[model samples]
Target: MNRIGIPLRVGLVLVSLIWLVPYAWMVVTSVKTLPEIVAAPTAPLPAGLELGAYREVFESMPVARYFWNTTLVALGIAALQIALAVPAGYALAKLEFKGRALAFGLVLATLLVPAQVRFVPVFTLLADVGLTNTLSALILPFGVSALGTFLVRQALLSLPDSILEAARIDGASELRIVYSILPPLLVPTLVSLFLFSFVFHWNDYFWPLVMTTDDSVRTLPLGVALLREQGTGVRWHIVMAGNVLLSAPVLALFALAQKQLLNAVAASTS
Candidate 1:
């Protein structure tokens, strides 16, 4: 068993290294000079460290503006998702209402329907509302997430019914119970929802691309795509540098929240 375990562990380590190699290359390439990057495309370390690519990335585009746009859109979407999803989740999990199950079933059905299938209709509606070229176009459409609603609902369902019954006996309104009693228990779910919304909006590319024609409205992903388009034959190092800058915040956020995210999942299951 020990001999088998040793070889299995070694194989897993090799697979993990292979998976991380591309990301490692991106980091190394970002700091490498153009000539050196071309010379050693897969070098584990920077052949000669240089800040020129990073400088070029900042100089060539409004990277800061792109970052700000993405941040604002992501935050707005997360807030709206939480606002809409939490109450909806609570109602579905606790309240006895007509068509409640039907409504939830419809929401579940929506998960089966790909967003791409509705893209044209959504775009047309936004166009009609005169929000096609604005950040609202990106943020509003994704404000109500089916997955968030489902996750929050499941979390709520797992709570002891006695607590809710006690709240009702004490004459607490549904809204009051939600705010005072249930909300505290839902911190983990809320955090997970926030993280999900943040990442989704941050990394969103297609909807933003379709909605915003102006350079000023572009998010980081769209900005990166535009950079790639314009920077042909200029070496990929500058683009890689821009990618690093764009992704650094997301990576940091995930690293910080990963522990909390895992703990939340474990707590929910327990």
Candidate 2:
């Protein structure tokens, strides 16, 4: 068993390295001079490492504006999603009502429908409301999340019913029970949902691209796409640098929350 495990571990390590190769290459290429990048496109190491590409990227585009736009929009969407999803999830999990099953089924059915299929209608609605060319256009459409509602519902369902019943017996109103009892127990679920919402809104590009024509309202992903388009004849080093910069904060967020996310999953399952 030990001998077989040794080979299995070695193979897994090799596969992991293969998956990380592209990201490693992007970082190395971002620091390499144009000539060096062209000279050895497949080289594992950067030649004459420098920060010139990053400097060029910042100089050539409104990176700060893009960062701010992404941050504000993503944070707003995350806060709104959590606020809506938590109460709805708690109701679905705990409150008894006629048609509860039907309501939940309908919600689950929506998960089968791709958001792309609704894009045209959503765009038309935003345009009709005269929200086109504004940040509100980007933020409003994503204000509520069905996926968050479902995930939190599942997490809440996994909690002990006796605890909720005891709280109710102690003269706790439904709202108070949720605030005092459920909220503390559901921290793991909340953290997981927050991370999901943050990442989704942070990386969203298609809706932002379609809704806003103004450069001031563009997010990081759209900004990176614009950089590639406008930097014609320039080396791709700048583009890579922009991508690296755009991805850094998200990477940091995931790294910081990874432990909480895992614990949340474990707690829900337990």
Top candidate by lDDT: 1
Model 2: per-residue Cα lDDT over 1-270, one tens digit each = 556687799999999999888788779889988888788877778866799999988887788998999989999988888878878888898789999999888877877767678778988987898888888888887777777788779888888889888888998988787666776887867787777778878999888888888888888899887777884585778888988998888888878888875664564443
Q: How many backbone clashes does candidate 2 have?
A: 0
lDDT agreement of model 2 with the native = 0.82
After superposing candidate 2 on the true structure, give the runs of residues whose Cα lies further than 4 Å from its correct spot: 1-6, 160-173, 260-270
lDDT of each: 0.84, 0.82
TM-score of 2: 0.87
Candidate 1, after superposition: displacement of residue 144 in Å?
A: 1.0
